[model samples]
Target: MTIREHNGVGKVTWKAEPDAHDYPAAASYLSLIAPGAQAGDLVGQLQTASLEHYKAKDMLRASGLPLLPPDNPHVAADLAKVKNNKALSPVLLIRGDLTLGIALQIADGYHRVCASYHLDENTDIPCRIADHPGSRVSALAAAVGGDLVNDSR
Candidate 1:
């Protein structure tokens, strides 16, 4: 989907795939929360995962993460990218395990997500998601013909 206005600027464009640098960024962030090896593993999964789309509001809700203010440096930079017609990279996510009370992890592109939210809460954000290795949610979902990554929300 195309977005016509963001912060009173030009249209929002999304990259067909995540930038090459995004994997390392995601691995760096994931390392803090998961084992280094597992972080690498998750990044690998994200690399091969199919692209998916979700509304900005739904991502924030599922992540249980507070939206970054538009004035935040990173967020502002992303807004500027939109203003300049630079395509933003697709977000990388680690699926949440509700049973274990783990909220979805925004492994990378939090600022971009916030920027998209600033544009429109209902804006569809492109994302690539991976299941947490230890989470049984994906397993159960697969068993029951449900999907853990591409949530309809």
Candidate 2:
């Protein structure tokens, strides 16, 4: 994953080929990366949730990480759900080249990353990053690429 600037806002973006290794955790994180979502808020919640998941499990495999005591009860509860399932959908945060700068600074998937720290703790998430010089060209290019650009002005 990489951070980039886009439309005067900082954003997170990723680029990776679709593969089996990618998981739901990444997808979940991507859903929350939006204009209004705060990085700190999401990261905290994700970490708490991951810890909660760890605590509930009796014995985790070598692939999993142990849960740590949580500062907030609410997060613990959310993480419990994740733990019970033993599997999560991957969330992805992706942006064209232009937004890479913003995404990196904001650390778009910070929450999920934090959560991963407690859950898997050793692996990196699947991030699909794109490279756009800046919004002026990237945004416009994305629109054109998607066929959303009607006016050529």
- The numbered model that scores best in lDDT is 1
Error of 2 at 65 (Å): 21
TM accuracy, model 2: 0.30
Residue-level lDDT tens digits of model 1 in 1-153: 344454554578998889999999999999999999899988998999989888899899999999999999999999898878888999999988888888899999999999999988877888999988768966676688754555554
Q: How many pairs of residues collide in each model?
A: 0, 36
Model 2 segments beyond 4 Å from truth?
Answer: 1-78, 95-101, 105-110, 127-153
User: What's the TM-score of every candidate structure?
Assistant: 0.86, 0.30
lDDT of each: 0.87, 0.34
- Local accuracy of candidate 2 as per-residue lDDT tens digits, 24-131: 443344446533334333333333222111211211221132344433353354345344433332332333232343433212333344444444343334433322
TM-score of 1: 0.86
Give residue 74's lDDT in candidate 1 (0 to 100): 96
